[model samples]
Target: MPELPEVETVRKGLEQLVLNKKIKEVLVAWDRIIERPNIEDFTNQLIGEKIDSVSRRGKYLIFHLTHYDMISHLRMEGKFDYVQPDTSVTKHTHVRFIFTDHTELRYLDVRKFGRLTLLPKNTAMDYKGIKKLGPEPTPEEFLLESFNQQLKKHHKAIKPLLLDQTLITGLGNIYVDEALFKAKIHPEQTANTLTFDEVTRLHVAIINVLAQAVEAGGTTIRSYKNALGEAGTFQVNLMVYGKTGEPCPNCGTEITKIKVAQRGTHFCSLCQRIHL
Candidate 1:
């Protein structure tokens, strides 16, 4: 699944590739991928609509059209490719938006788990998926005090708490592990038990890690690519997420891997001491 940074990268690519282009037609090869309205209605509504801009919230991509906002979630293996009208469609190509200029924006998903829903203009936030997401970690609204207050209310382990989209949007297993490791906070520590100083360090770590990941175009653990079909480079800078049994960068101790909140979690056990 694409995290916040991956989604942002795709948003940027789509803005460059598809912005202002009027849709000549919308072709749905797999009807199930359209989550809102009947397939016939969806196909008819999108025709002749112009893609004004592209934006992202959490892991969802928002395509702002003249008449509607198309919300797309690239769950797991969903990807978008931009090509000329003459380009051949692959077997996995589920949705195709043929632009007026004879170009195409194609959505391909190997797992077919990606979703697309249309909401009326300026009403995308009312959609259930967008309404519940917490403030984006990259923005000024995600203050340290707010983060501290939210942490105090959760008894769950820090790892799973951070993964909650309702608390803080856009953090997944990879960046959570990286942030916790960087802050030297044990993933198993109860959320409310964190000290003010610890929380401050963690807050900074989360912002820095996510910002760096976005700058690096997000980490491509497996088959993740931007809208331009370019793989991410941040994986090379990863410290402990997938470095199981490898020596910790800060300390020589081997990095440990454990199942935390049903997700594979990596950490430098000696470095991130439990502070209760």
Candidate 2:
């Protein structure tokens, strides 16, 4: 699934490619991807609206139009591509945004887990999914005390707590484990038991790791790609994620994998000391 960095990359790409383009029509090859007031209503609302700008809130791609906001989530395999008027649509191509300029914005998803929501432009914050997200994980919002407060309220394993989109948005399995490993904190550690220093480290790690991932365009773990159909370059700079049984960067001990919150977690046993 595409996480924060991946979604943000797509948002930026879309902003550049589609802004100022008016939607000539919307064709929904998969109606189930439309999670709003129904495909017909959504299509009618967005038909002639101009795409003003594109941004991201949590993991959803926010496309601000002249009259409404079209938010789309690339749940798993969903991707957007800009194709010429003569380009042929492929098998998994589910949604197409035909532009007045003779170009088309195609949405392709092999897993069919994507979602699209259309809401009023001025009321975008009132949208249910966007309304529930926590603060963005930028430098200004990652205070140590605030992070500690949220963690102390959770008795669940740290990894699972971090994966909760309600607690702090834009984190999924990949980045949670990566952030934990970078902080030298074990994935299975109880959230409530984190020491003050551990909390501080974690707060910093989340911001640093995510920022770095965005810079690299996001981890090209599998199917994730930018609007240009290019793979992200962050996978090469990873420390421990998907590197099970490999030597740890900080210590010579091999990294291990275990199930935390039913998600495969990677950590360096020697470096991420338990009960520290």
Candidate 3:
């Protein structure tokens, strides 16, 4: 799963190359990828609309168009490629946008799990999934006090609650495990049972992990790449994400892997201990 940094990297690349480009036509090769209003309606809403801006909310990319907003989720293997007008369409390229300038914006997804939704212009922020999302980790609204309040509101294990998009958008299994490990908090520990100091440490871990991941263009564990198809560099800096049995870089403790929320979780038992 591409988290905040990976999604943000895609957004930045696509924004620079595709923003202000007028849409000449839209091609939907895979009908299932179109999730809202049907494929015909999807193409109708996007064709001839100029892209005003490209932004990100959680892990979804938001393309602000002239009349409507085109939101896309690059779930797992989805990627956008910018090509010239004469470029040949490759296999697995499910969506293509022909620009007035003779360029192509192609969305390729091997797993075919990516989704596209078109909402009306001047749409309210509370539209469907957007309505349910909590504060962005990087946004000014996600302060330590607000984070503590959110933590106290949930009695479940801290790991799964952090993974909840309603509490904090874009956190996935990898980032959640890494953040908790950095804070020395056990993944299965109850959220509201955390001490004040643990809460403060968690706040710092979330911010630091996200900010650093962005700096490295995101952690590419598998097929993740930028708009240009370049692998991320953060995987080299990871301490506990995928290092299951490896020794921890900080304390030399052997890292361990467990399943939490049905997701593979990696942490250091010596670092993140649970009394329960």
Candidate 4:
């Protein structure tokens, strides 16, 4: 799944390639991908609207159109490709937007788990998906005090707490493991058990990890790609996420993998000790 950085990369790509391009037509090759409104209504609503801008919230892509905001979630293997009209559509191409410039924006999803929904232009920010999300980890609103307060309210393991979208909107398994390792906090450590210093360290680590990931265009673990079909390079800088039995970067101890909250978690046992 594409997390914040990957989604942000796609948003930047769409902004450059599709912005101000009027939609000549919309073809929903897979109706299940449209989560809101009937497929016919969705196609009708976006036909003549222009893509004003593209933005991201958490893992969702927000396409600002003339009269509506199109929310897209690339759940697993979804990707957008910008190409000419003559470009060949692949078997996985489920949605295609024909632009007035004779270009095409295609959505390809091998897993078919991606989703799209349309909301009124002004009410998009208040939509259910965007409204309930917590503070973005990279923003100033995710202050140390605010983070500390949110941590105290959750009694779950630190890893799962960090993954909670209602608490910190953008973190996923990859970044959470990296952030916890950077802060030297074990994934299984209870959230409320974190000391003030630990909380401070974690706060800094989350911001730094996410900012760096966004800078690197996000990690490409599998089939994730940006809107321009470029793979991210952050996977090269990863320390412990997928390095099972590998030497730890900080302590030379072998990194270990465990299942935390049902997600594969990696850590250096010597560097990140559980606080039980």
Best by lDDT: 1
lDDT of each: 0.92, 0.86, 0.86, 0.90
Model 3: residue 270 alpha-carbon error in angstroms: 0.7
Which tens-of-lDDT digit does each residue in 3-50 have in candidate 3? 889999988888779889998889999998988878888887787899
Model 3 TM-score, 2 decimals: 0.96
Misplaced by over 4 Å in model 2 are: none
Selected candidate, larger lDDT, 1 vs 2: 1
List TM-score per model, in order. 0.98, 0.97, 0.96, 0.98
**In candidate 1, what are the lDDT values of residues 112-140, reduced to their tens digit?**
99999998998888889989999898649
Q: Which ten residues in a row have the lowest lDDT in candidate 1?
A: 137-146
Model 4, residue pairs in steric clash:
none
lDDT of 2: 0.86
lDDT of candidate 3?
0.86
RMSD of each predicted structure? 1.0, 1.2, 1.4, 1.0
lDDT of 4 at 62: 89
Q: Candidate 2 lDDT, tens digit per residue, 28-94?
A: 9999999987988988888889988998889988888998988888888899999999899899999
After superposition, candidate 4 runs with Cα above 4 Å error? none
**Pairing residues by index, what is the TM-score of model 1?**
0.98
Model 2: weakest 10-residue lDDT segment is 139-148
